[model samples]
Target: MSVPALNRAPDAVTTRVTAPGSRRRPDIEGLRAVAALLIAVYHIWFGTVSGGVDVFLLLTGFLITGSLVRAMERDGRVDLAAFWTKLVKRLFPAGAVVLGAVLLMAYAYFPRSQWTTVIDDVWAAALYYGNWHLALGSVDYMAENSAASPVQHFWSLAVQGQFYLLWPLLVCGAALLAVRLGRSARRGAAVAVGTVFAVSFGYSLWITATAPVWAYFDTGARLWELALGGLLALFVHRVDLPGWARTVAGWAGLAALVLCGLVIGDSLPYPGYASLWPTLAALLIILAGAGTAANGRLSANRLLGARPLTWLGGHAYTLFLWHWPVLVLHLELTGLERPTPGGGLLVLGVSFAAALATSWMVDGGVSRATRRLRTPAWSLAAGVLFVVPVLVAGSLWAQSIERDRQLRTELSSNPLAYPGAAVHLDQDLARNLPSLPVYPDTTTVARDTIDQTRACNALIDQTEVVTCEFGDPRSDYTIALVGSSHVRHWFQALETLADQHGWRLVTMTKNACQFSSGEQRYRGEVFTECAQWNDGVMAALDELEPDTVFTLASLTSVRSGPEEHVPEGFVERWRQLDARGIDVVAVRDTPRFSFRVPDCTDRNHRSECSEPASHSMAERAPYLELDDVPANTRFLDMTGYLCQDDVCHGVIGNQLVYYDTNHFSYSFSQSLAAVMEPYLLEAAGRAPEAELTLAEAALSPEEAAEAAREHDGSS
Candidate 1:
């Protein structure tokens, strides 16, 4: 399973070691160093989670809560403005530096298609809402093919920033309520914090069970981890363990802290019960050092306080900020998904250097320069200097991407200039691709790939069948295409044919769902939503009673391995259509690849990305092997046209075929319209019309423009 991209811990709100009344806890600071290192190591070597993020959350809760409680006792109220001033000044300078650097690196190293995501993430990270942004994207099926954002690791910082904003307010409320009830403010706050811990923890368990991907980045689901640390803070001063007991407990907790990531990796559900291993381990270490004076021989206090670890701890904020981006930059620069051990070391070394330099600029230069003018207002102003330039650059870069999309939109108008798949179909149109520019260039191919059925299709959650009609909608001759996204993406081809044949085109599709009732699973859970959608599609077909029902009779599974077969449910559906005297076009399912075609084509010549015919599908269509075929169901296999001579080219006739790993590009579908015309017409129980000349058969310039305009989304 692909783990969610939330694999790192974050910095605390501030790097101030000693609060007004509290002494520095170098051990906890060094734990921050441990957390930061665990994240980097686990990510680069294990390719999984390390629970380091939970440790960071626990540390933030303990330190920040302790600071706030002390202030409440001393000042007689929670100092909101003072806390905010210190946080914005101390935290954002280094954060802004990282975001700016990521933006520049993304522009240089990342693909243009990824620029939009980087632009959004840069602003979101700058404004402290990146966690929510990532939470939403985690469940977006369309974003499944995307590469990790350079600044994606900033989500943990965003979560901490949000907590810092709300923690003070919650404690203040608890303090006010305590005064009204004649109770100690500290005890009252502890009670409130415990309540938050319980509720958030319960919600975390439920969300992780049902939607683990979204749960991983959810601030609400993670709030309890921080609150647990808050509870530890309120009670730590009272833990009066014997010195020997403290030493033993401290070492045990340290061992457990390192073990949590390795033993309970991301293969298990996280920020839930599994997260307790790391959170409680961090709390135990902090508790062991509660009355810190001298370090024990093997205690966490001594181990974490090694001079180098302490230094990394002091600068953990910038180290956390720089490590993931540095690692991702290495991957983007080289086309490798994961680095070699030596490469990982290089990434870490670069991360350490960048972190130290960034820390010096933020801590030494900025703090020193502002020392004389070190008012709350001055800190806020200085932080803004780091943030505004990045936002401005993001806005300008976003505008440039839009212009690139607009220019590419014109490529569809001149067919001769970029004939796409037509070059493969017609002898006169055949041309070498090397000289002609690929329309919908690699820079914007992702945009060109549209949800062709969004106007008619159901979302993953939507059970009600939705339909959209196109191409001579009022015509008596009609065709209804029903199935999964494969059928949806084929709409351009069907639409082109319907326009020529003067037939109404109806599409019924749901993402990740085929017209089957065999009880499939989506994201490792029973796909009840898809099952319900199939039933609804059946009902809709009965009501419309179109001349023919078009669907994929065979299917391919990229996960199950490279082979094609007919699902029993597909045969049942075809038989039902046949029983109703509805003619059917059971188009053979297409091959799905393991890599995103656009990304591969961007870095390599398009032809170099081709897969072998054996990997594309089974030797022939599986439905043809059936003992008894449904009478009215005519199967259409275009594998011959798609793959020839034991090789499936990624680019054919100067046109890229698949948009993502599985789906066809809209232009490629249009190019296939004429090729599939005879079988589709036969499926609709209509005789073929006289063939037109290649020039006459092609979509007119006006029709091409119309097809482009009719495509979904702003692009």
Candidate 2:
């Protein structure tokens, strides 16, 4: 939500601010205050949206339309340059200030892994494309559980700024066509805005239902809220309500805003049709009191015009800007997920004070100085005062991170320094025992994922069992790696063995999806997408019929605790493989630490980062106890290589072991190749040489048809 000052350029264009008079409405001022404060309160304590952003969008559309339409009507040509320069003056100064503050906070507290992202967001916010940046990150499955960005709240401001850049051109273009056809310019602009509302609203609805997380920050999905506000501005004067009716509508609209936040904040998709609740509520408040007095009896409009609210509304822009970062920073400083009531009040008080001081220094002092000249050039130049410094600082910070990465990459080249799991697996390879520096650089550890090993797993929403082939694709011996991300991480070892032994390797993995015959759940919801993907995997496996099918037979419940078991899904998948006469090499599940291993290792000694290895596995393999298990199924245990003395350490053989909480580091996974080679060879050697073409022929006619259908539908 931008400050109203950004919309309040000189009256040369906005003289027709309302139908009744050029003076601003006190009730609208109060409404702006309510919107800004509601966002702050909801963010601090409720951890849910308050739809205050939707209200702000409506206000901007109404105000911007009034300014532009009036300018075009008076001059016959819209001054796009002047409008842009004025916007720069009113918005950039405050935006730069906030971005600068965020950078300082990030440097002080955020981990080194987060610097690249923070810098990227600062650049995006500075350029007013923050919304797209956020939308893309939201859709990327690897970005899950990321720390909250302080500048994430700038997304709405970016959407508003983008609208400012495009809306005037649209209005001017439509007005010209209208004049050629002898229609009124205002009527033409209204038609154009209405079309935008309808088209954008439809897209919003479709996108919201299909990809709600991405939709929340997508500019296209949010454009309708602003367009709806523009429509209100174009014809607001045509409405004339009785005083008592106006009062009733005004009160109802305000209550509706409060209720909208309470009812649908967490459950429903936003800025689509669901957002009409708050957008229309704002429209009601505007329409009810448009160009009217608030002096009637039993007046909701009069209540809105209370002195304190109107005064606070004057500072709404800066208040909104300051509150979010302040809340996020306070939470970081306190190590609290959310602030207590006293802490919330403390955060609010500090944000209010900062807003006041910033307003005085920039809005009052620098603004008064800029107003003396009042030229477009001066406004732009003055607004750029803080922007240049932010860009320079961000550039320096990014370069420093890259420099540190280069240094680490060069130092990690020595095999003796980072032998990974080799020191334990191979006793002959001698080096300084436990005194070596950790490798893969824990500062940049999150990137040390299976993607670095294979770059081939599907995202969570993906249902296609896409295959990534490595090593000798023409080799007669084929090994199929299938399962969730846990198994995907083992590709570092599999790919190494494939290269050395001249065997073909194919990986079919989904991020959190296990190749299961039974029902699978992700985040406690029925994983229908994974179920669909599993069917595709079965079809593909039928066509490939590899000598040995390699997958996980055990599961580690990462969220609950460090505990391992052979799931029914694992047994079910192996059972189908058994029916096909394919050999199985099921590896025991890896230990998944409940805490961030890299984070712990970064700040503590190796001893402090160790977890009891007993927590990961039972005294005996759980799969061995199951009745009616596949006779051809074989088990592989590398627990001795990963754990020693009943302990699993964060850093193994001088290499960081895990990137996130559960997944293995690419380097550590590669280190297990030598130890795992013998077990894989034994399973593949005993398997019968069954041609895949014959396996396909063995499928029933109905099964073949279904497999063909699945292949056609896969991505």
Candidate 3:
């Protein structure tokens, strides 16, 4: 094998006599084939190749850097503009082709609603900000059942681009220092390479221990592989090896990489200590081809140096670009995972065909067409123009997805309606938490719960001050609504009745706040806010004993574990309220889902969203019971509003009862006025006391009509 004789070209190069000592290496191409195949297998079956992509990254850094270093040494100086020009020629055409194809697929197969998100992703990929955007989106690439994201493969490209930006200056600096320091040029280069390897390896080790994801994504932590190659390039000419040794090392290196997918598989943690195996394997192969394999017949035997593999190698960059987007879009459209065994094989076949064809058109056709233009600036501009729109479109699409999501949140303030609602909503009690989407903001404006305490002596014509005031004290009974967001939903119905009954409703509930006195983690901290607020409410109740205490107790026992029935330490808490001469009654919580059932919208799939039947509610009795409470505490189950016959449907009375997976809509609750009045009377011990019919207390035609009008206007 022989290297091409040193020569300079302003913009174009003519063929020169081959150097006597230089050679072309077949083992390097075989190694590349092995890396690509491993990455493909891992993305396909995953059980076969786990950390194989890191091997490819290491090889990319090594091979590309090795070529640049050799050119720089011969030229005696680095040409920044020329270097960048060559890179743009090498990378952009294939990337642009893949991006354009992805956009076309998005238009055909994706829902119109997803267009915004996909557009933003396109723009991000074009700008090389895809990895940062993914990080902010909290995307986990290693998850088992993720939706097919088009730019997930770009994280590796981002890492590579970071290296490309920094490596040339480092290499040129090392070359210049060698000339200036009066040291052997090769030795100076070795020192620079050694420094990079030592520092990068150390950083890699540190990040692997503390931040493996960052380590895997960052270029700095991965520079050691390229450094190892650069160092090898300078010193390999000095070593002498027997033919058997060369063959064994070369074959062994190739075999190690080929068998890597089978040995390591996809379950490995990735780019951590485990990556050293393949990186070292790639290193060995590159080193084996250093001295005797330039370009001669003996150096490049036909079997190892076949034109097919070489041509594939030539289109490797383009093939890599096309394969992932093809596989991703195929999966997105089919949702078949891969055509497993038969299906997977078919998908692989189609993917390979598309990749090769696109590679030929984009890499070969585009490169050849652009090569004769002669002007570096114009060629570079053409490449940038092709790549930029696709990238901008991807970025814009992602932003649009976010915007659509925001609009959804604004339309329905229900926590469950918005994907990231939990993080954005404020939970304070003074803010009209009774409204739909506005659950009880538990933290009172009067931060000290005791300061907000008051009595309802003005409206209630009763002996005991059972009601406690919190927000406004001007209304009739000064009724205090207590419990969690579940309790707050009832306030919409309660507020209507409260106004009619001349009772001022005071909300004292928080999201997930149980009546039972217990400590629980909320918003990443142990929250005693609910319990503390409850204590303050009870104290206020003692001070402002109104006509009666209207409290909504959540059905907490259903979600309890076998060993932990009700929340511990909270059972005695409610009893203390009862002992203080205040009535403590609980309304069971509505059912929550393990998955989102969006068809439960007000009118969509109404039949399927009907309340549960009588029989199904009875079957769920074990989960519905309030058996853990003291006898003095009364339990009111509102399950009837959400149940019909034997099954619980997602809606009631032409309204989306459960605004989210759980929690009733205000409109739905108003419709349940008839259902709730009887239960409220029974729980308040007034149904039998007054011997009144449930219909008398329920909402009549006039009230229902007015409420319906209000809902219509709001909607």
Tens-digit lDDT string for candidate 3 (26-111): 54554455566666666766534444465556555544445555665676666666656655655666667777777878777764
Instruction: State in Å the error of residue 128, model 3.
Output: 1.9
Write down the TM-score for model 3: 0.61
Q: Per-residue lDDT tens digits of candidate 1, residues 30-119?
A: 888898899888887777788788888887787677776776666667557656766777777888899999888887877655667788
Top model number, TM-score: 1
212-233, model 2: which lDDT tens digit per residue? 7889998889888888888887
* Clash pairs (backbone) in predicted model 1: none
In angstroms, give how far residue 527 of model 3 lies from its true place: 19
Q: In candidate 1, how many Å is residue 15 off?
A: 4.7
Structural similarity to truth (TM-score) of each candidate: 0.90, 0.88, 0.61
List candidate 3 stretches off by more than 4 Å. 1-21, 47-49, 139-146, 184-186, 213-215, 238-240, 293-304, 392-715
Please give the lDDT score at residue 78 for candidate 1.
59
